[model samples]
Target: AQSVTQPDIHITVSEGASLELRCNYSYGATPYLFWYVQSPGQGLQLLLKYFSGDTLVQGIKGFEAEFKRSQSSFNLRKPSVHWSDAAEYFCAVGRLGGYNKLIFGAGTRLAVHP
Candidate 1:
């Protein structure tokens, strides 16, 4: 079975600080990796995704992530955090066989302090 795991359930960081969210996965083969962010009571928005090519990928909202196939991990990172960036982050994995069935981790809630 394929699964996604996020080590942190919640994270608190002061405004303008740096941020990094960890993600790990188990799959039979190379799987599609993605990071998504959701505001309070809002739908999720894609932060980044790794499909096939390069080891690093960038996405909207000033976010980026590096794909490490060796460790079966794709971690999300941001150089600086803002109060507006406070939200729940989820790591997900999918199969490239057109399954489109995204398996999401429990999620990590980020709190930004002033």
Candidate 2:
């Protein structure tokens, strides 16, 4: 079975500081990797995704991720984080055969200190 792991359960950073959230997956083949952000009391929103093509994929809200096949990782990064960026980050892995099923890691709660 495929699985995802977010090493950091919680991260605190000053506003405007660079941020990187680690995500590693275990899969037989290259799988679809995604980063989703959930604001307080809100549903998850897709931040970025890596399915194929370019290894460095850009997503909404100044966020990006690099798919490193060798590392089995698709880590999310932001050059500069805003106070509004404080939220829960979730890394998910979806099999190539289906999109409906996604195995999510234990979310990383991000706290932006102003």
Candidate 3:
């Protein structure tokens, strides 16, 4: 069974400051990982994903993530934070082969401050 873990329950960052959100996964083999962001009362929107090839992937809204197999981690980073970026972020790992079933972490709530 595959699972994802987001250690940070909540994160607070000031506008224009750099931000990083941690994510870890457990899987038997190379896993398909993804980062998604959700605004209040909205659906989750895909931020980035790592399936194969590049270990470093770019996402929307100036977000990027690096996949480190050794640590079994895929952490999201943003060079500068914005007030509008405040939202709940989710890390997910999808099973290969079959359907689009994704195991998601508990989620990390991001709060932006001035």
Candidate 4:
């Protein structure tokens, strides 16, 4: 079955520090990878996606991810995290001709300390 797994259930980091969120997927073929952020009581915002082509993909809020097919991983990275960046991050995987249903991970809560 095609699914996504976020190893870290939650993470706490200091403000202005680098952050990396791990994501692993189990899919038969190279599927569409995406990173999304959800604030408290708010809808999820698409960070980035990787269909095919360049392995390194950039996204909004100064976030980026690298798709490693061999590893079946698409990890999200941020150079410097801000207080506003403290939210729930989700890793999702889907195909081109699927039901358009996005299967989200358990989610990784990021806590930023000033």
How many pairs in model 2 have backbone atoms within 3 A of each other, for residues 3 or more apart or on separate chains, i.e. clashes?
Answer: 0
- Write candidate 1's Cα lDDT for 1-114 as tens digits: 789999999999999899999999998877899999999889999898899898889999889999999898999999999999999999999865666789999999999999
Positional deviation of 63 in candidate 4, in angstroms?
0.2
**Would you estimate the TM-scores of all the predictions?**
0.95, 0.94, 0.95, 0.95
**lDDT tens digits, residues 1-114, model 2?**
678999999999999999999999997666889999999999999998888899999999999999999999999999999999999999998866645588999999999999
Indicate whether candidate 3 or candidate 4 has the larger lDDT.
Answer: 3
Which residue runs does candidate 2 get wrong by more than 4 Å?
96-99
Candidate 4 per-residue lDDT over residues 1-114, each given as its tens digit:
878899999899999999999999998765899999999999999999999999999999899999999999999999999999999999998866747677778899999999
> Candidate 4 — which pairs collide?
none
Q: What is the C-alpha lDDT of each candidate?
A: 0.92, 0.93, 0.94, 0.92
Q: Which stretches of candidate 3 lie over 4 Å from their true place?
A: none
The number of the candidate with the highest lDDT is 3
Q: Residue 22's C-alpha lDDT in candidate 4?
A: 97
Clashes of each: 0, 0, 0, 0
lDDT per residue, candidate 3, 1-114, as tens digits? 688999999999999999999999998776999999999999999999999998999999999999999999999999999999999999999866778788999999999999
Sort all candidates by lDDT, best to worst. 3, 2, 4, 1
- Worst lDDT run of 10 residues, candidate 1, spans 94-103
